[model samples]
Target: MPVARLSPATLSAVRVTLPGLGVIAVAVALSLAVNRLVPAVSPLTGAVVLGVLVGNLPVLPESARPGLKWATRRFLRAGVVLLGVQLSVAQVLQLGGGMLLVVLVTVLTTFFGTVLLGRLLGLPRGLTLMVSTGFSICGASAVAAVEGIVEREESEVATAVGLVTLFGSVSMLVLPLLADGVELGMWAGASVHEVAQVVAAASPAGAAAVAAAVVVKLSRVVLLAPLAAGLSIAERRRRPAAEGGRPPLIPLFVLGFLAMVVVRSTELFPEAWVPMTKDVTGLLLAGALFGLGSGVRVRSLAKTGPKALVLGLGSTLLVTLVAYTGVRLLG
Candidate 1:
């Protein structure tokens, strides 16, 4: 008789991770269903919303934590890296020196300006950094990437995610209603929090607008690696040896992101691979967001309500103004 069975340790590991993984899997499925039924809502955003519902209503169980951690850490990083597959250096370069400058100035001003504003408003640096990153760069995905660098609380992550959802949706709807609205796809692509939001905001402008917005948005995305690396360096220095050992100069995941960008730029991958890669990246990110959302404590999030609302509003306004200005002048 020949038999094959799992090792004891392997089975133990599965036992530890499975419950959380199960929950994440189910959340993702439901999120996807919601998105399918409501085409206006992105599955990734739906994942976080559903996760918040699950965590808050039923209360996420302790036993599910290990898998949640695994999902957020591994899946999130992989998704971020794969995001590069959608971009090429040439796409960004097409924006020309002026439009590229608009993208750069907008990102830098929004990020730093939000940080300074948060400090003045007495918000925690972690919350500010995450929120600013979300507003400045790529939304929830950027917040997730920087979470590892700054080691923020899950509640803070939820709050940052909340603001991204709130203002991003507003921008998505409002941007298309403006004068030269569709043309402002460059502005939407520059300022809106999520890529999905940018696409939604710009898509009505036609394929050309969508194309312009995406290229500009992806340029902002390319900033993630450097911003994260710089933050990681500062964070590693700030912590004492007693608190933790020094981390890599740049997080490995960030490096992986850069590598993917290079792969895409070189045209090493077939054009046909683009859609498949985007789908995979979207799924992975949605899963990670669900995991993060499961950790939220709403009451804690409320503690920062007034200040957070103000900060979120301000950040949104700041980015919008900057992006609008940049695009008007340069674009």
Candidate 2:
């Protein structure tokens, strides 16, 4: 067998990449432990929290940043692609045309409405869009999905994630206490920020509620692809032709996402692979969030923080009301 040779550039990349990735791996382990100890504290959210904590610390090595960024890009794409495996076109269809309409309407309304609100607040469009995506769709994963296309500041991504975590946690605690189990389940599933947050909010109501919330939440997750496409087109048109090379109308990872959706729909993979896919996807996404968090500078963001926070509050309230209206009308 021929000896495998490593180029100078490849060696340099490996050297820099491994250190940051290793940092995220340790962070992921701690996040996983925290999730186990407190089931409601999702590993993905924990990963972002831990990353933010470590990132703000004064002594973190420069060598690790490249790997962390690598995780943000590579791992994020992989996670989004695998995210589709958790959904099926069949699951969405089972919701029937009316419930499907609810999902579609909720997404469209929240997305555009948040953009309008952000304009009125004079916040950056990127920050508003990321916030909108997180609230309107699936939370941090959704936040990260549109991040590249929006070309916003890293602080904005962290802000969006923070908003998702805060509002989602609050919704988890408060919704169940309203005393309508099944109805609340559909409503929370449609409106809640994160998947785990939805499940946590609904679990107290029992299994049927949990199932309803999850199906609705995953239905929302299905919209991520088209949302990416629409944003991409908008971004393309907004930019000058000479600004740079144009972004694709539909990103490659989105196509990968769609492909996995097909795989899940056709039962192309054995059911045994599902659990594995979930675990792998979870790890990659958690690590990716950690990477994204590392780029945020808390003090540096102080100026925009308040505006983003207010926008977040408005976006959350808006999505919640719209989703409740849909649930009530369609139920």
Candidate 3:
């Protein structure tokens, strides 16, 4: 019998590079193809789907694990940093008081309601909270920020994030078509989860609708602090003993995001650099989404199945109806 020989260093390098290379290849190809053909669906969404599908296909060889981890982590971090470039304080404020109130109500109501729904459905508490926060706040960023306080298992976070990304992407693709028929601009504004998703969904609705959606999404983002504070207090009370016998402090990222907003409003950054910052932020968000998808297990996600899909679709419709009716009545 021939003796099998393995060099640990060589094996490790192979393990890391293989999965990373496969995922990147799939993601890039899918993104490019979808962008070229559909032109309507966002490339980021395609990248995410590709990542999740490829990542969960099988366990990587031991030798390739490190390289895969490093690539995914770097991608996520770059996406987050790029996200920051989009937060110019001045534009957010320009949405004014009425738009601000709408955002606050939508975020708070959806978040708390989702939590209740999740609990009633008997979902894991941490997963429930993660899904609720991700849906009601800034999507993946909200999940990441809350993860520190919640101490949820990484698997739970991964599953919740995957669900959010799936539903958010679906909304981006479907909502604009619905808007064309319904002419419900305000409804679309409140229903979509992320700024990018909102913009993508509303693109077909003409400039007026797209502008309205952006304002609505940004307005919701502004409420991140109060929402986080409320959740922190609620979580603390719910798990006083587990959380070091004290309330958790609100995440610092919210503050940093707001601080950046304030600084930008002060006219500190050159105007010429603003667009570049926005582009960078977008790319970073795409990378983070890619990273998030990479960590998810498609088989496990399939287990969530019809129930998850139903919940997401139902909640979205409920929010859309409420927002549309409320806005119409109030306006």
Per-candidate local distance difference test = 0.87, 0.88, 0.64
- Name the candidate that leads on lDDT: 2
* Residue 221 lDDT (model 3): 63
Candidate 1 per-residue C-alpha lDDT over 193-239 given as tens digits, one digit per residue, 9 for 90 to 100: 99888988898888888888888899999999899999889888988
Q: Pick the candidate with the highest TM-score.
A: 2
Instruction: Give the range of the ten consecutive residues with the poorest summed lDDT in model 1.
Output: 176-185
- Assess every candidate by TM-score: 0.94, 0.95, 0.75
On lDDT, the stronger of 2 and 3 is 2
Q: Which ten residues in a row have the lowest lDDT in candidate 2?
A: 300-309
Which pairs of residues collide in model 2? none
Better of 1 and 3 by TM-score: 1
> What is the full ranking by lDDT, best candidate first?
2, 1, 3
Error of 3 at 272 (Å): 2.7
The residue-level lDDT of candidate 1 at 103 comes to 87
